[model samples]
Target: MAAASQRKPATLQFFLSAFVVLWLIAAAFPFIWTLWGSFKVELDFFSISDWTNAITGERTQTTHGSPFTDAGYYGAWIQEEFWRNVLNTTLVCIFVVATSLTIGTLGGYALSRSGYKYVFWLLIIALIFRAMPPITLVSGYLPVFFDWNVWGFLPTAIIVLVAINQPFTLWMLHSFFEGIPKELDESAKVDGCTQFQAFRQVIIPVMWPGVVTTGLFSFLLAYNDFAVTSMVLAEQNRTMVPAIAAFLGTTYTEGNVMFAVAAVVSATAPLFILVMFFQRQIVSGLTAGAVKG
Candidate 1:
């Protein structure tokens, strides 16, 4: 009986292991394929003749002598000035994350401490705003932006992204603040610390994990946004994602599809690095409020 039971469990474990392996391959294959193809020429990468040409770099070998070439990267980064877009994206992310966290921390702390019934309704309204698509806001801003002549600038895009990120930031930070003990702030107040002082000294240090996680999301929003950035930004002031889109439009027709592919791989590298380093903080922040005492 014991032997039979063990056999069934072992069989189940084997199937589960196989399923996990397949799932990981499915998830990782696209990035692996893109990275591989980025090193090859368009003909071999696209490979209409034989799919193995994509793997073997057969046509790429003919053109470049070696199987791999950095021509795509050279075209995008050096010839096309893709680094300007990278700088724009970095600046936007910094401004948006900083601005969002500043406003969100204050507002969330206030909401968590206040016992008013309106606070509940305010949170509900925030949820509603968060649910709305960002594109919907563009129409409303177009007239104002055009009239003000600030439509395609970095500051304009940064403000819009910060506004979009605020609702979610408020909600997340409020929950994190709530998880922290009220006594910490109260004790500081009792010792003659002003509300702001208590918040700065007592609460702020403890909230870093949650703040870091929320800031990561804010950074991602500004970094990855294509629709709003594309619509608001002009040709000279475009961010990386929109620049990549523009590359796709012109490069494919110019027989430079690999430039777009290279741009994509370049764009993805920072995010991968961000996740690798801060993954622990992300998990900690997510679970900070799960089982509050």
Candidate 2:
């Protein structure tokens, strides 16, 4: 056996560490402020003691800003609206991921397999629509949705989200399908399988990493979205991010603190879980089409 020699970095490590620390500090302040501000009343924001708006018009609470610091932390975050927002965000994320992945996977497979001028145009149009700002799409589509009786509020949001997500996921998994050898499809057809069966039984299992990766992107895209949802959803129907924004209103109360804590809990939990769950497949999918195997 050969003895292993250790490699050492010179001055780069210290500078890199300092850079990361500064960046982290910069990032941490806003969340910390939000968290801390949640605890104290709106009047207590500036003064050492709690007072009504009449005593001190200084409304913004200092404690509400702190992400890491709170009086009761997660224990105090249980409120009706908080839980409702959590449920709303979760449902939207799941639906968006599932719908986008299914539609994208099937469409991607078709696009990759067939050669048609219309498909090219469609792809280009979808890409263009996706490239445009989400607000633009929301603004253009809102009046249409408003006029229609069947598609108001949440349904409208879902339709718009699915439209946005389809292009990105289709593009991702289309490249994955292209990377696969055509012989597999032919071989499956030569056996007892049809085209749809080959896709379901053969292609899907083989390229699952790509599918999973697409799902991950869709999940996060829907989960963290605020702007489009804000435009489409009313205040009562607000999702997680919008709910967090609602916390910073003129009247800061216990509900605001609860909302902040709920924000931290819900924000981190599912996101971390999904990443950890699909960690292996996501890594492979990200690198899959980069090089020939």
Candidate 3:
């Protein structure tokens, strides 16, 4: 009877593992297919004649003398100046993440430690702001930006992104701060440290994982934003997402779809690397926030 029970559990475990593997494959197949197609000419990648052409790269071989070619990348990055858009995106992300985290860390810490009843109301207000769609907020900012002649600028976009991202950071970091014991702060105060010194030297070190997790989230917001960036940024100041959209073109103009495909691959590769590098911290940070000591 014990052997039969063990056999049942073993079978269940095998099935569970198989299910996870299948799910991962299903989730990954689209990006994997797109990555493969990024290296081929449009005709081969999007072949209506034979769907197998995407896999075999028959036309790609004829056109480029190889099954793979870098022409799309060259066209997007060099000829069309996608590098400039990449640089703009980098600057926007840096500024947005930095600004959001700075404000969030400070504000969250204060609110978490405060003795005031008003803290609840303030957090509720922040939550309301955060819950609203970002696009709704963007429309309000447009008139002011145009009036200030600050429209279509990197700083303008950065400022807007920071505003959109700040409330989330504040909420996340506040929860993290709450997870930390107040005893640590008292211990630092007894050790001749000021409040700021305690926060900077002791509390922040412990809060590092939470900060990293929050920062990563803030980075993603600014990195992946399409609506705000597209509307606020001029053509010359466009970021990767908007630039990639431009590569797709509209009814009025022709677009290089392969360039967009190649650019998509280029844009997505870094995010995977970042998550891999920070995976441990992310998991631990989330775990810490969810569980109270």
The Cα local distance difference test for each model comes to: 0.91, 0.70, 0.88
Candidate 1 structure, TM-score to reference: 0.93
Q: For model 2, how does the per-residue alpha-carbon lDDT over 1-293 read when each residue is reduced to its tens digit?
A: 24344434557768878899999989876556544544544334344554353133344334445323344344434544567777788778888888888888999998888778887887787678668888777778767766875333666677678888888787777777887888888899999898999998889889876787788878888988887887788777778887777765622554444445546655666766776788876676667636522
Predicted candidate 3 versus true structure: per-residue lDDT over 1-293, tens digit per residue:
46864656678889989999999999999899999999999998889999999999999999989999998899889988989999999999999999999888999998998879999899889889988998888899899999989999999999999999988888888888987999999899899998899889888889877888899889989999998999999999999999888787741155477888888999999888987899886676567546732
Specify the poorest-scoring 10-residue window by lDDT in model 3: 248-257
How well is each residue in 169-288 modelled by candidate 1, as lDDT tens digits? Answer: 998899889879999999999999999999999998898878888898888888989879999999999999999999988987898999999999999889889979999876765665
TM-score top scorer: 1
Residue pairs with colliding backbones in model 1 are none
Q: List candidate 1 segments past 4 Å from native.
A: 1-8, 284-293
Clashes of each: 0, 17, 0
Residue 205, candidate 3: C-alpha displacement in angstroms: 2.9
Descending-TM-score candidate ranking: 1, 3, 2
